[model samples]
Target: MMTEPAQNTIIEQHINLDDVADLNDTNPLELLVQATGLSKQRVKDAMTKGAVWLSHGKQARPLRRKNARLRLGEELHLYYNEQVLSETVAKPELIADEGDYSVWNKPNGVWSQGSKWGDHCSISRLVEEHFDYNRQTYVVHRLDKAARGLLILAHNKEAAAALSAMFAKRTVEKHYLAWVNGQFPHDSITIDKPIDNKPAKSIVTLKEYDADKDRSLLSVQILTGRKHQIRIHLSSLGFPIIGDRLHGEPTQSQDLQLMAYKLDFQCPITGDKKAYQLKTWT
Candidate 1:
């Protein structure tokens, strides 16, 4: 059997080449050396190891070819995440493999997609690397960096668009589990608040309340996809999720006590109703 490769620690930083007028049309290697104050050979080594990236506005590409030219005002991003640079790979546990779409349990610390740094630690990249076929994977939805559990991906663009549409149309039902500080007032409550100037709704159900612990376990369902919707809504209710450092008061635990617990939706590609559940923090 083949052993999985070792994961690398990836470090990253960004440098803007906006004011370097003389560096226009100069070789990327030369500019990177000047920008980073590293030797040409060191810069070359970093580039060869897949650490250097070039960005033009929202589009970013890794620098691979030798003697690549740098356009004026282009951005160079250096990835120093040594963990990602190493052979260590993060393998996502595949839950179910549909023909056009699949479900996987996304663990905390794994990105849903690639960023300016690299794709090595991203779920999309990991999923693609897991398979040998030229077939690609597309992200249908995203789970937060600190949140865990059910994530769906599409094998092709058709499935991607369909699944994404389901989310946008509110045809998909998503439930999350969380532990919050203090006792909640209602057994089930709805939070209807505008998030980022967009309509956002959240339904929260109190599953359990421990008086001795002064904590409540909740099931949350979001009706809109807004950034930090659950965290913001729950905190607005004065019962912030435990371990949520950003929304709640800092606790000794650094792990966020939130997980995507269940999902129910019709398969846009197969036209079959589907449901999935994964118990977390129960």
Candidate 2:
């Protein structure tokens, strides 16, 4: 029987070349192939997945193309991680396209940020691809990769700044829905806990209870956005959301049960009230 490779087992290396003859080579693919002694298809696949890089002096960026000419004296780097690059990215649903800014239903496991290996699975990168890369993409806020639901991506700088300011000023109303492991109190409760020495608040209201599963469906509105505020607050109360491996107990559902179900706020660019919610919930 064959065995699957562990996720931690990976090849990560930076190849540097300075010889005069090696520097004169213009083809990045040929240079990487000869230098690393890897197959052409493997090298090409690495480049396309953003595992290749070009660096000079202090500046460095990903090099994501094959058959591209390389500049003399510039350094070539390859970060080959078969585990990271091979994982599939979940698809996000575009809820509304407001031109300057758009709303999306980000699925669980979809990242809000990109990594050195690549951002092919990130919502920010996905939004850029949605517009065919004509408009610049800006990230105003983020949702946890394990939690799914509503997110906004600003298409331009002005919109990005304005929307970010709204979050900073706490004008954006963010609501979350979670299925927790235990039964919660019938009365709504407000948790005013200090997270990381900063004041954070979350108001949780019970919507339904499953007698069979002994779990509760909760509606959580966070007044202060801290890192994992909702998850931390609920877990602190001993009603950890199901599948929250980081702070809560493991459950049957492998995916995180928490979700940013709704976003309500005044549109900064249009001065219109905007409310977006997911059509379906689990």
- Choose the strongest candidate by lDDT: 2
Global Cα lDDT for candidate 2: 0.83
Candidate 1, superposed: residue stretches over 4 Å from native: 1-50, 54-60, 63-90, 132-134, 280-282
Candidate 2 lDDT trough over 10 residues, lowest sum: 1-10
Report the C-alpha lDDT of model 2 over 15-115, residue by residue, as the tens digit: 56565375555577877776656667876877876778889889887787776666755778877677777777778888999999989999998989877
TM-score of each: 0.74, 0.89
Q: How large is the C-alpha RMSD of every model relative to the true structure?
A: 7.2, 3.5
Over 1-282, each residue of candidate 1 has an lDDT whose tens digit, in order, gives: 323223343335566777666664666777666655555665566675557898899888878655877776578877754445443434678888886878988877788876544566678867776676456889988999778889998999999999999988989999999888788889999999999899999999999999999989999999898988999999998988887889888754757888998999988777889999985562
Clashing residue pairs for model 2: none
